[model samples]
Target chain A: MREKSGSRVSLRAMALLLCALIGASPVVAQELTTSLVDIHQGSPLSDRARGLGNGGYELQSGNRVSFNQWYRASWVDMHVDLLTQITEDAGILWGFGTGEQGEKYRIEPSLKLGFLTQMHPSPNSTLSLSLTTTIGGKLTEKSCQADYGDLGTYSVNCRLAASQMAPEETLKYLVNAKPESQHLWLNYRVTF
Target chain B: MPARHLKFGIATAFAMLSAPIASAQEAPDADEMAALCHGGLSICVSATIPAARTQAATTPGWMSPDVGAAWAAGYKGKGATITIVDDFSSTSRFSGNFGIGVQTQRHGEWTREEASMIAPLATIRSKDFTTSSSVTLAPGLNVLNLSYGMYATAGYSPNQIGWSAEEASIISYATRGSAIVSKAAGNDSVAVGGVTNGQQDYLDLALVGKASAIFVGALSTNGTTTNKAQLAWYSNYAGSNPLVQSHFLVVGVDGSKTDLYGTSFAAPIISGYAAIIGSKFTKATPTQITNDLLNTARTDTLVNYNASVYGKGEASLSRALAPVAIR
Candidate 1:
């Protein structure tokens, strides 16, 4: 009789534990795996090809920027720019982080805003840099045919200084040198 | 006190009545497909893929010259029908190969010519479904050869959102006695660790739809002469980060044979072998057949070796057919 009572008590304890575990799981979900904001900065162009003469092209591209010439090659900025992170408490956070950026191209003409990340991040808020390689945007217009001889092997020419789009919008903006244009930049983002 | 005992009895009866009801709600019955060959038997071949593609052979089907020889050796996959499932060209209709009439127009034809090469006297039924579609799999189909991978339209992320829906139906056919063989893809993605597709790890967290799938990966074409069986450069590997390591098998894909690229090519070889094996063991379930085949695979000399990559090693067709003779 004593053993039977003991077994019954143990069964009740097991059931209670199971119930408690199921109930407590919701709380676990609330625990932050990573921080909300780590850092955001303009990264280098991954596949941007610098005119390495002799028919050979040097690929260089940007990370933290949006551009129209996704199907075309991107160029490197001649000036020095510092990109940094905005952190709360310094610790490692992982998972996906989203942020926005605004860019005014000195020569290129375009407006852009979007999120960027390489892959899923650890469930924590960390800051790091990552680089991404991608193909340029496609050219569909006959005017593009006249400007760029071939649809392939073209580059994003940032030398075109822009004030505003013409009233007719004849010139389809290709690459935007602004950070907002970067849809998803591959980078080695450091979280600290 | 008497009322409490009455309550307990009622509870026990209620529990018994609810058990089957819950099961019925949880898992419904599976579909039934008509058998294709005689008494619904088949030959299940699991060969390294140099046998099928025309480019690989001097006269086509050269890698497994032994297979045709086996047929000539009086080991006809006779009285058996084989169903091959692959992303073949729209016109190469399987009928040109399997020697059977179009059982259903929904899929392509399996020509008797190919059937003559494997089993001279068997009826063949071929079914082809676009990789994206969730088609119902049937039993008694003798042998079902899936010579393709979980192909997603290019540019799409490898997410399991659409695949989960069809898991139950696929699992049902596998549970029943259906000779089904799927190529373990040719891409050499190591399945030992979590296979990162593009950039995400594929996890089989939900066991809702998984059978002992006969997944066959690829090896170099040099035959058994090579010491190590490196996972073909494109075959995706299986491992446990989301879970544990449970990948597929790898057979030969060497020689002058060029059709040895994707698991898509390797699947049919196993399907052909399964047809041959099924001919011998007339009453084996698809699950049992997969087990016996895997159990009979050759051991490799690689380290940290587990079933994730070299599943039961390379498939030995003769041994699987003549299990009792050599063992």
Candidate 2:
């Protein structure tokens, strides 16, 4: 029995090692274009991205990278675009006495389907419109904090009660929450 | 009775039982095992001991329902080591009879057994504090099970409780976040720092504010999803110090099941739980594992849960094990 149990443990350890190796491997993809952009309203990356009333006015800046593939459909031209953006060191402020305030980083990856039409009225002018859908969720490490002054100072690190730490809001969501945003985005662009 | 007297008694009994055997055989028959526990030896024998031995013979070890889910989920403390710091006779005596079904009547022996039962795959090491106060921590994830207390005469202040090498090593480890230290909140029926019966356990005072130290209290029975549990009548409480309360946790002792009672039995459960949590979160620091257990403890499972009384309430192994990231 001891031998069997030892063998089972060895097998599990090997499996865990394989999983770690796979998870640690870097993701590789072709890069097309990179640009810095700031969202003034309704950014799909932030948790507070509902609207102006819900603090959507908070400016979010990130480096946006676009990957594109072009194809000709019967009459008009078409292109599939992949937009990837990363918001680095974004501040996550907590309400009074709610938790320890901190910062988080997020990455938003989206796909866009669009059509292109040439205009004869203007030389070398083109019009394009695309439906962009963004997909993202909690992508940062979880943390716990408490105000040692407001809550009585405790000997333990992170003195607040577990409920006060809001683990369900911070840690649980990392495991069980769905994509943060999945709304249709309409964009029109004029290029020369 | 002095510890030396008990040690001599146990050694003599074992010698008598082993005299007829030429080679190592199956653990002494049940009748012989029972005889070893006769007279003052009842401390080693309980109604559950024989049954537990029978069960251990067939299975790896006994696990309480509270930690059963973690075991089923392949987190049976495979990568962790639990160093039990208690009195398990002398070094030579313990080394001679430290294996499955080899029961002894020492405080540390039962504590070791309890911890192994909870995390069957966890590496368990004995540091007989009676012989030496120095504890050498094992590599990898470590949980220090201190089911025994270092006490002083009544009215001794925290500063006056001369710290031993063992205490210093444990405090240093806990302060440095090197290991999770699970200490038994003495069975004095008073607050954690309260004095009882002419002595005070200063180990509790020294551990306060340490990064990964936890004071474990006992509940009368196990709490389940449907039923809530209550603090054992003799268990020490968290008291008014929020710092102490923040690091305190309570687990069921279930004397009827283990045939042993007191905060001593409660500490091993938490130690085992820490090891199980470490098994899952292999990358988690000792402090992270400590916070994971404290942050995920269940208040609703304890009747009229009060932080001052129950500390962090009943430790929920399932809740602690639920999180993918233990920060």
Candidate 3:
């Protein structure tokens, strides 16, 4: 776990949520000229490697103990966006997103720059076309913690008395516990 | 005969039944499989880390209830001490190519490793018994692990000779002192009661007399399914007497990082558990700790779930350390 970096992300996300809730009043909303909505979504493009392995033994108290195990996880994600104007004939469309990958969800930060073209076939109907591409986003590799102190339950097997469950069973328990990708919506609609 | 004389008598008779003691078979050590990270753990030893968190992270069940989850929760057996009494040597003592099993440095080191891996902070001492007449408990030792046991020769039961005088002395000392003795149920399949299928083990009546002593049996998991593990085919489990049933316990001895196996490995697991439990309930007596472990064990982990084979069930660190509630 990236203690410093992860905490920073958590703080920023909390701050963003706090700001969203504060300015949500209708009176404050009407004063703003821009009516904008941003949406993002993603999942893995391929299967993730289980990435579990064990080294042999080390001396502890002058005795040999099992070497710890290792684990890694990677996933593909997808997100999208839609835009429209309230009072202007010319409209602007934009999309920006990120992917969650590697051990700590190394944020695949990407900024999308796009232009929208509007075609008015008649007074009653209008069609719009937009194209956007993201930049500076890539997946990072995640492996099990190399250090025992950092591994938590990852380093030990779960036991009921002397009889214990398998090593991966405990690992799966830990992996299953971690939060999956968040803040990405596959489909979206705005209500007025 | 007096208690001391009788204790010596048991030792003499045990020696008479044996000469060069029958060697524990050189079965391929299964513990190496544990190094493969068998029990569903996601972590393994890397080519990194300081001297070692001692692989305490990966050996969750054998060392800690949840793979050092107890340590993270801050209940490592810091103040407790475990005394291992066996015909084991403290040092390797050999050059290369010595394929030693239980008879030499390999066994003792493996047992010590298992206990230390679980309770790294606890003190572990090997009081060798190769030439000694009787085992002694160190002043502060809270747990004594006896991973060796007498053989059942000529198809005879354990009662033919009360018990080994050396072991009996240790058990007697444990009974009167603050220490608890962890004994290995022998390898013979001798049944505790009338079960014909038995391994030559500690199915003797002498073991029942010591309230402070516990007989440990080896266990093995059958598959990935939860609670699929069962008593190792060779582990002894005779429950003809009440104390045997009350004092008996089973722990897993699957392949460990170092290729060790048998009840030899099992005894130390309980020893480690005892130390860990003792660390949490510093005020609890050795009897209290022993009883709590027996009382709180998880029988569900047994495949057949029979008290005759599993004793009171597998020892559970979490249950023993959990707070005792009042109405």
Which model scores highest in lDDT?
2
Judged by whole-model lDDT over C-alpha atoms, candidate 2 comes out at: 0.52
DockQ values per model? 0.00, 0.01, 0.03
TM-score of each: 0.39, 0.51, 0.47
The digit string of per-residue lDDT tens for model 2 on B47-144 reads: 21111011112322223454544433334788899999876664432221222444545667777877887788899999876554667888899999
Off by over 4 Å in 2: A1-192, B1-63, B90-104, B324-327
Clash number for every model?
107, 3, 51
True lDDT of residue B243, candidate 2: 88
User: Using DockQ as the measure, which candidate wins?
Assistant: 3
Candidate 3 error regions (>4 Å)? A1-192, B1-57, B60-67, B89-104, B139-141, B152-165, B192-204, B222-225, B256-258
Q: Candidate 3's residue-wise lDDT over B102-195, tens digit each?
A: 3324345556666776677789887655544566555443888766654433355444555446655765665674687887765555544233
Question: For each model in turn, which proportion of the native inter-chain contacts is also found?
Answer: 0.00, 0.01, 0.00
Clashes of 3: 51
Error in Å for residue B289 of model 2: 0.7
What ranges in model 1 sit over 4 Å off? A1-192, B1-69, B88-123, B131-141, B151-160, B163-168, B175-179, B186-188, B192-209, B225-229, B238-247, B300-306, B324-327
